[model samples]
Target chain A: MNISHAAKASGLPVKTVRYYADIGLVAPAGRTEAGYRSYDAASVRRLAFIRRAREFGFSIEESRELIGLYQNDARSSADVKKLAAKRLEQIEQKQRELQVLHDELKHLVRACRGDNRPDCPIIDYLG
Target chain B: MNISHAAKASGLPVKTVRYYADIGLVAPAGRTEAGYRSYDAASVRRLAFIRRAREFGFSIEESRELIGLYQNDARSSADVKKLAAKRLEQIEQKQRELQVLHDELKHLVRACRGDNRPDCPIIDYLG
Candidate 1:
């Protein structure tokens, strides 16, 4: 299939499919004589796997590693578990940081009068 | 003051200060005799304000709007409140999305055995 068909089947955007190919994350099977990118069923499968990995918040490089492991029959589950653990740690840290930011912003918003007057504590807080 | 001094005073990185100046988000006071970017106290204050606004999760364009409102004495507090409310809404949306992602990833991680064996549910799930 062509890029559009591959993208549709993989549930990825056209630009993203192109980007993955450009970055060598997931290349098409081959190119047509007219120089358009060509994808086979296997490529579409890999693309869908990458899309799922990305939706799980794995980085591009991590997705590449997961793809490698997914293809290599000898690869161990421990490596995949380690990467998922690392991602879990990152997510937890981000959640904590976001909670702090959310609380501070909430406090500032609560203080602001939001009236027609020019006086705003939210502005003052930022300033 | 030079860019370094401005960055230190505003608690922003040197690259960020230059980027803000280049994008006209926050311009310097003037060019020195050697054509270096010179920042006055007022510019430093504005840079700090922008830094705080960004920490509160405002985009560059939104930060520009907040800066404009901060500078304009005739501006109403209601407009600033509106911007902050929009940001709060965005943060809430992101929080919900992250929660969903976190939960799904946690489930996948939990199902994985993390052992030496090649059989892994995480890989199977992605596949």
Candidate 2:
């Protein structure tokens, strides 16, 4: 299939597909005589894997690491576990930070009268 | 105070302070005759605010917007509320995605029997 087809099948935008290719995230299976990228079923699977990993909030670097592990036949489960553990810790940290912000914002929103008056705790906090 | 002092006071690295200035996130208060960037208390406050906003997971662009709100005395509380709401939504979405990934990883790890044997469900999942 063409890049567009692969993109559609993978649920990623054509531009994103091109970008992944440009960033060496996903390489085309082959190129047509006209120099357009071509993707086979395996390429589509790889694109899907990349897309799913991205949706899971893996950074490009993390995705690259995961992909490397995916390709290595002799890869140790321990290594994969370590990477997953690190990613989980990072995610938990982000969640904690977001929870704090969310709590603060909720408090501010609640404190604000949200009326026609200019007085607002939200503005005060921001300022 | 010099940029180094401001950096120390703000709990940011000198390189980060310079990067923030370079990216127009923070501006120096004044310039010395010797071409050194100088900061007063106001600059320090601004840097602190920027760092705090970053800790709250606001992007550089979002920080810029919030800074504008901070400076605009006549700004509507509604505008700030909207931005905060948007940020909250984004954070929630990320949290959800991360939660899903965390669950999947936990499942994979649990399925993997960590033993001396080479067989592993984690590697199977990755591959």
Residue-wise C-alpha lDDT for candidate 2, range B15-37, written one tens digit per residue:
99999899998899989999899
lDDT of 2: 0.79
Off by over 4 Å in 1: none
Cα deviation at A23, candidate 1, in Å, is 2.0
Which model scores highest in TM-score? 1
Model 1 chain A weakest lDDT span, ten residues long: A101-110
Clashing pairs in 2: none
List the candidates' TM-scores in order.
0.94, 0.76
Model 1 root mean square deviation, Cα atoms: 1.5
* C-alpha lDDT of candidate 1 relative to the true structure: 0.93
lDDT per residue for candidate 1 within B89-115, as digits (tens), equals 888888888888888888988999888
lDDT by residue (tens digit), candidate 1, A9-112 = 99999999999999999999999999999999999999999999998889999999999999988888899999988998888888888888888888878888
